[model samples]
Target: MDGSSPAAAAVIERVLAFLDSKTVAACKTVNRTWYTLATIQSARNIDCHILQLSLRIAHYKRKGLLKSARSLTVDVSFVDGYLSPAAYERRVRDAAAMLQSSLMPVSHLKLHASSAHAALTDGEIHHGTTAIGLLTRALPSLASLDLSDCPAPLLTASRGECVASLGRLCRLKWLSLGSNDMSSATALRRMVRANVRTLVKLDGRGDVTDPTMQLLMDAPQLRQLDASGSGISDDCLLALVRKRGASLRELILSDCVRLTRHSIAQLTPKLLPQLASLDLYNVPVTTDAYQSLFNAQTHWPYLRDLKLKAAIHHASSRQESRATDDILESIGRNCPRLVSLRLFGCYGSTDSGLSAVLGNLGYLRELVVMHHPVDPLIDEEHSSSEAGGSQSGSSNTPTAAAPAANGPSSSLSSDADVWAGIPSLPSNGLPQHSSSARRAVLPLPSTAPSSPRPADAASGASSRQRIFTSGALRNGVRSQRFNLLNLDMTYDSECAAHLAKLSHLHTLCGRMITRHAKSLIEAQFPKCRMMVWNID
Candidate 1:
């Protein structure tokens, strides 16, 4: 309906709110009133690099842009289309200029200084600090600040300056100081103390200690806390939750050494009924705890992402495997809304258990399995005599850029079916990106003559060669890897058949998958990207 009348305008506005940015952008072409409304919606979250911001500002017009904008991300990584220490400083200056003059409506500001591809230098760090100072002071309406992606060294070095600059802002609703160690106790306390009132979501992974937890417990509005890889004890976590449990929605405690099954299990539904995500990487979870926490009757109704990577040293294969099985089994029955699940190094999950998980979680987008590098492709732990037969590295070595095809000594199978689920190789024989349109029948895995077993690893160390990892197809929502991962996992035909049935599935990664099953999955899902490993 046209916006001629007030009622019609209200209805149109309400409808626009439900639609996504692309849909909202398309609505602009309908009429003048739609264009004006759509423009505001489109500019609501302005996420761009320092280079792209000026262009976006020009398109939206400075005055309209300032009023319409709500979130601004000055990611300096994309400047000059490459990551260079020299160029980063200039982009930082450009960002500072923008934050100073413009961005009144913007409340959420993300200052991504450098990238993984770029090595951090003193120049970039200095400029990054300057940019942070300018934005915190300039943006009076600033409610959220995401410094998680910024280089850790920069954040750690300029702790005092950052705390001082951030204190200038009245309060922040969300603060992320994770991904790197900037968790000095004194500085963090001051920072958290300043933003305690409005702060709701806090990511202090690696830095949040028992003392910090004490301060966080005081924050009245705090709901989400990611204290993963921190030194917070079970008693502290239990105590903090008791104080802040009413509104706590997301709690990530991955790699928290002191936390045991008892403390985690003690987290009743009454404490965090609205808990949406729980990560316990390397933390051993008991059957009773999983059943209690994930049980529909007792606990979480909205839990979505559950990362329960069994503790390697603390967990035994047979025992932890059963725990993994129990958790996955309970998932379909208990946590149906679960779209992303991570179960790494759990010895118990067979093809049937995995198939059930895939089938049950209909809209399951991300599934991470066998992440812990428990067993390498070529076992280095054993000696030549212990291994029974150790192959000579020289005779069967693959190159750095592109590894050799499945040879007799190659870790994977030589059967054609093994490549079924993944995309077909191009005419040049290089692995291409996953595409449904160009479906070429792939050739069989080529084999080479078997190399004689070497006496010892040291004798063959110089002869060793590099293998390939699928960097192009890597889709890491959970980690910087594919969905299915097994360096030496037990995969078979039945599992492959059931997994292939998931037409929505995109990325597949793992090892020791049977040739026949791998082929079945590859053939069924022609668009799926894969990084499969050996059979035996």
Candidate 2:
């Protein structure tokens, strides 16, 4: 009964396989059998790095655990001065040779680069030797490959050599070339065309163009396609969203600057009927279009994940417009089944906006929003993600996860199953750096930068009891609060009470929030932990 079934051993193996590192440690005290199961599961999701590359590989080989690695993250990324340039290259060469020869049948492989601030330093240094050739050449059996943190694109030894070798790869199920320069468009397209039959999820990181989307219509099983920040045209986008591609579920088109709300409104229920997660990061959508696209009763009744950024098109969008607020309200009323609602540039939103989302969407396990507008200093071009979990927030999505995409410095990343990571967003090839912004989250082992904490909001803490209300959550889903918030506005005691009611808050970025409110919330829910920006 201690495990998944009424008996200790029954179904325990499956249950043990899902525990994170922390949970795995706790399982050691349960019993020897459980300890063994937890240990194996932990080993399955180990990190293969460069600090002692050969030693690590030898250890894995000796134990015969190399072949059992389900989700392997070979994060060899270090800073510029971490080691001498010669030493760095030598270690990388040695690691690559070993990994190539070892041939660990790891289904999922995540490759990292030298440092998060690779943008400011050398151009293609590969500080940690996160070379594409190293990864693809070594893990030939990779079914899922993620390179969101690499210094450059998948050009390992030579210009087009490693990418050309992608043709030899076993049909990939999941591939994320996060923000890496995919200028080798022809080669990248060829690889996709070849693997069209097996490629299920692709995180292009916005480096792709219209042709890639065109090539995917024939992809019978392509469920998730993230073209965030790509130059995909409206016509091509519409063409791909048809009955033929109805199997498509998650579609991300953030910062497709060419898109208009009118074209977006055309996406009725008839197009990609199985749509669940839609992320339009920086895409310009009109107020009316927002309502129509998210028409739960009329359109996507099964929609779960919805990400809409505030306007990036200043000329077309009206400043001080209440469009975003209205849109959030509509979402709460319509998409009640939503699991994750992430809004990045929603500077126009106020208390009412977040309140509506919190009130409805009772089943929401992850709510990521920029509760306050970004100051001029806050970087928006870079992409930052956590190195903690998998791709999706939930466990059913992917075995391993990354941090949330906080623009390459204010990082965090995942969900229940979607190989939890930061929206599976491709980086701009350069890892992000942190700023002196304040962010708070459930305690965890993290490295996000922090600023000065703010003073308590004591003067405004009136003793009179206040009813901070947010219409009842959709379900009596009490154990159901999972949100990641980064706010800069000052809150009174009443605001804190309202937030406290949101029981399932997962992570929060209180960059300029008062200390009292943060302390109150952390005391109630102490689970999720990421980025460490400071308060006012």
Candidate 3:
């Protein structure tokens, strides 16, 4: 029962360890020492969901328990189980008051709120203005602020006075205002111009326009930018490329359908040199565009990841033959360092193109080629070759050829010989090392069973059935293999698994993977130290 006894010290140590394991709520029940440690840890990553938690955190500050805390997160979302809007607002104000008066200010603050429901509300104008006001006045020392899913009403209200308040945040380093409808790009430009010196990462997805982009391009410290779904044109992207080439690391123009090949060509030299990752998903880029991107000796030398979704077209006619081949060859040769490549829904790519990639990109770890025509080489034809080429007098051979027109038929002939080359891995049993080395090949889901067939097959009909079933088998096998790890069939699971396996993976799209997959990945890869998953 002695206060200084060894037993008392051991008990205190056990209680501290238990508190460390539990979250803020559970830790609160422990004694004073445990409470102190919990407060410190909780304040490191504050969840501004429950109003009472914020209130209690404020109380701790007043009592000087959280003097050593450095970071605070304020999330105002109903999904996170935050209080009702009115009550949440009051709590925010209370916390802001504490922050404003605290002896030690939080160095970093994150704000996440979904105003989609508010945007659709009847009295949105009032609600939006009030919410913006509360946020603008809160967390004065915030170094990073993420305003994703902010309501359109809030973004457009009062001529962007709220956003202009964002300019007043002199210490802000990162700002992400994705998925909001900012009606006036001019106001956003003003805000960007005002805060250009301190801002580093700018993500104005779907809301940014040319004028706002111009302002961001002029920003001094801006390094990472994501304007995906922002309706950004080639000209706007070019301006950014020309101005911010040296400092930039990542640029995502996904779903900007207006991005043409010519625009990409113009921006390539200026943007590709220092870029680590580029996303051109759903754009109208052609082979020439890719050629231009890698044409420069220094172009994307540091590039590690590239996403090309639905960018190319099939060589249906004679004119497209050279273009398609040129594009495929350029990707194979120039992007050897690419570790992660996603060619989702690209129609022009064939087995030749894929073979070029696999042969060159030896260090690839994650490759996604979903929705493209499945290569007979990787599907039924592969197994057929393994069983030995077609037997003599097999009925599979066509007896009569179609009458020729002007030249060789443009359609891909089934009789055309598939590539039989198999590249060897290095002595380490890994692909050659490259800065860009993640490879993923997601073909159209196989219709065949997952199991491999015997050496001999009886009929052509059986082979066709197996080919059709290949997609189903591939999906089923991958899902089953990773199911115990909680991985899904989507691109996210592939990405998460890749990261878990390759410890060096960065700039992953968390949306492609599920939360379950991420957890499993963390459990699997204890050595993976730095990872930032952008779920939204």
TM-score of each: 0.61, 0.62, 0.59
Tens-place lDDT digits, model 2, residues 380-446 = 2211231122224333432111131224312221121111225333123322234321222211111
Ranking by lDDT: 1, 2, 3
Candidate 1, residues 402-434: lDDT per residue as tens digits?
232232223432222222212122123324434
The local distance difference test score of each candidate is 0.59, 0.58, 0.51
Better by lDDT, candidate 2 or 1: 1
Query: Could you give me the TM-score of model 1 versus the true structure?
Result: 0.61
Per-model clash counts, in order, read: 8, 59, 33
What tens-digit string does per-residue lDDT give for candidate 3 at 1-536? 22256677566544544454355557656666556555555555555543444575666667676666565555544333345657655665675566566645566655555554543443444444454555556656667766665555555566423655665677677777775665645545655776788888888777688778877776878888888887777787877778887788888888787778768766563554678888877666655665666452534456677776443333433222122434654665676567666654433444345445545555566654433222222233544663465556444543111112222432343110111001011012223323221111221123223434323322221232111211211212211111111111233344444435443432222112346656766676544332221221
Q: What's the CA error at residue 194 for candidate 1, in Å?
A: 2.3
Ordering by TM-score:
2, 1, 3
Best model number under lDDT: 1
